[model samples]
Target: MILTGDIGKVKTLLALFSQEKEAKEVARREFYNKEYASLQEIISVFLKKNESPLKEEPIFIVCFGIAGPNINGNCQIYEPDKLDWQFTIRELRELLTANYVEVLNDMPALGYAIPKLAESDLVSFNPNVSAEKGNRAVSLATGTGLGELLLYRDRSGDFLPSPSEGGHANFAPRDNWGLEFLTHLYSQFSPPISWEKVISWSGLQSIYGYLKDRKGVKETDAVKNRLNREIPHEVILDMANQNDELCQQSLKCFASLYGAGVGDLALRTLAVNGVYIGGGMVQDILKKEITKHLFIEAFMNAFKDKEGFDKTKNFSKRNAAIPVKAFINQEMVLMGALQRARIMANLD
Candidate 1:
């Protein structure tokens, strides 16, 4: 007998289901150049490649948006554009009876999961605020697209997940150099590339493409070669380390804007309590560009109303008594997902 699992019956999101090897080696080489592709196409490509011969056990699928905090398993069916506003359990039950549905904030899961991966305590901070207590953790991933998340811990030794559409937040440029970079970026993309657009992995291409277009170098070949040969994070850092003029300027634009964006989130959430920087790109920055004094300088550059903001800056300052640290928990998202799953299962 064939038994079908109710979509809502899923306890937790198992893991991101994209065909990894296929995505990197095959799908990406074949179909990833487009701006966006249908979900069906993505699923079809993924499923076609992973042909596992096994019994058709009743399986639960947990789904959530990149920015959604809640882990409702039914977001897939509602079809609404906004993730937070998507369908709830009641609606999902209308379609399937045997399935379970869960909703969770993606960022918190990532934040919580990092600690699990790293097997250590984590300090997570993201641009968006989750209502949970304790320090927050946030990250932005740019492999296939942008993913923004928040991580928090409560008194019960549980991670409270929160998610944000922060990657879509407005871009705030600092310094004349930043202004120039933004201007150049805007002139190229029709809708205009925001910080999220410029800072992500794909965004680096956007940056390189924009630079080439504005400079009128007629070197699409050279730019693509750079992307294929070097990751943006490495290229930016290498340029900075070498102190090349254009590379320095590009990195300066990136660092200043990035610091400001982080500061803004810090202010909004009063993350003076704690703030962390993670993501594939941040790893490169910390390894290459981060310094206490310079970090503080770039961060404070955005506080326009100097007096109170300045005072608060001191209070929230990263210092010896309360130092800022990396997430340390590398597999945070997976752990968080499992924790959420366990909670959903009501395990002891």
Candidate 2:
């Protein structure tokens, strides 16, 4: 069993290896984090649902790709502000009786999954910019929370993946509107607000609320009722698809800021090999929102934004070499967890 956990939901994928030893899916289920008391319960449900398979086949390994708190320490999912559930490794080992059990931060799991990704799994908005052999790469995912992973080329020419909590890095403002947004966040949430505040599902909603309440962008009562009744991001995307002006405005803001934030990461990491976008939510917008081009433009502008480089063609040329690609697979995180699990069990 391979599981991936985030702030909003958890996904479990039951996989078996093919004749070539590649992991193939057997079953899958998604659980809302709020509905379950802990990760143990979620795993128990998956196990119970597949009683027949385990009875004959047996689960040899169990791995979890989770965000938040350290896997080696408390075995918890994120902090209290996020999933807030905790389970020790010992308990899981006992529950599964698997030969190997591994749990890690989702970023590293994503890192493990990158090199294995095929051409079909990757897409870029700018067709002219293709991935190249560079010294570094970075993966940034925006879901219920923001996630980042860094891949550095070693002396042997292989890219090594490493986990980073860079999403928790401080939010930087680029303009007057951004400065005002920062001030708004400071007023409500505690200090040391991170980029996750401006780049995730809740982040987009925060942007929408800011526009409606402070900037006075119009919002109708019908839209308000739908937002209250349904998922905010889903409703926001639905309204944007229907050409709701305020929803479109908020989406533009979210996409632009998300692009800008990624630009900062590209510069900071010098990720010339590739800048991979990995979350399903971000990809959903890239597929659904009409203003995806705005995201590309904002990304390029911020990526090339450098002091004394406004007139330098060399700066733009060097920055332009950074390839930005989005990973569209919804089960990428699960695939990643399976990859690690296979390695742990010596099945790959």
Candidate 3:
């Protein structure tokens, strides 16, 4: 049996895998923690639930796709509103008692799984923009935090995934509202604000705060109660789906900023093949009417909005025509981790 994990800020995903008599099988579970609990605690709770199966099957390898940079087999995962935590591959191997352990940045893991995705796993945002063959691709995930990665075909005609800290890049405001939003964020946080501050779960909450404080929007009792009880990001989405005016506007703003970030990534990477939008927040929004209209409009328009660069109109046009997709497979990161583990063990 193989153990795979995708550790992030809001949720830690775990999958137990085994080869069945006729096919490969996997069982998945999620651990939600506000503080992004220690890895030992997470694994302990997971093992408690799957004790019987674990006792019967000897785990072969463990692979973890964590939300942060993996430097020299060491990772320092950054959590929103919490201190960064460190994890090393050597320590992980000893703790899990596994023969091998692999740690990778979460976004690159999603990139690794892109080629393996089925047609049903994707929701095309721009069907008219056919993906160019042999071109590069980018994956941007917005969740507890934002993650970005680039994928290009190598000399051997195989896709190679590279992780990036692009999410930490400075946020560029395109309009008056964006400028005001940046000012509001600056008031709340320190200098050098990044896209992660505006496009993540906490980012949504920050947007909501700005809307409420600066725009003087009113939140209904339902929204207030939900905000007090559940995750603010979830609450905002639910309220938006329920047609709450303030929440709707907040979501629209978030969508636009998200689109802008995507456009920037597309331009930076020249990802002509596609730009994949993944993560829990995007998945939630995709289920709502907002994604069909407001989100796509903002995303497409931002990609083509090169008002100041009249000479680079063609570049904007090219970007506008780039294939943008929403990845619906929530297990993509885990699948990628598993695939990488197989590759590492020479089992694939």
Which candidate comes out best when scored by lDDT? 3
Residue-level lDDT of model 1, residues 1-348, one tens digit each, is 111111111121123322222211111112231322332343344334433411232223332323333343444422244111344556534432325444444455565455444414533222232332355545464433345545556777654556677777766664565576678767766654556776665555455455556655344343346657777646645554655444444445454565566555555654434556665465554454433233334433442212235654653333212223455443444445554544544442
Enumerate clash totals for all models, in the order shown: 34, 1, 0
Give candidate 1 misplaced runs (Cα > 4 Å): 1-73, 76-105, 114-137, 141-158, 191-193, 205-245, 284-323, 328-330
lDDT of 2 by residue, 133-211 (tens): 7645554656667888788876877566777878889999888999999998887799988998888888888999999
**Cα misplacement distance, residue 318 of candidate 1 (Å):** 7.4
Q: lDDT (CA) for every model shown?
A: 0.45, 0.72, 0.79
TM-score, one value per model: 0.56, 0.81, 0.80
Candidate 2 wrongly placed segments (more than 4 Å): 1-11, 18-20, 24-61, 78-84, 139-141, 154-157, 220-225, 289-291, 308-315, 345-348
Q: How much is 126 displaced in model 2, in angstroms?
A: 1.5
Which scores better on TM-score, 1 or 2?
2
Sum up the clashes in candidate 3.
0
Give residue 68's lDDT in candidate 3 (0 to 100).
74
lDDT-superior candidate, 2 or 3: 3
Q: Is candidate 1 or candidate 3 better by TM-score?
A: 3
Q: Which ten residues in a row have the lowest lDDT in candidate 1?
A: 1-10
**Residue 46 in candidate 2, Cα distance off native in Å:** 5.3
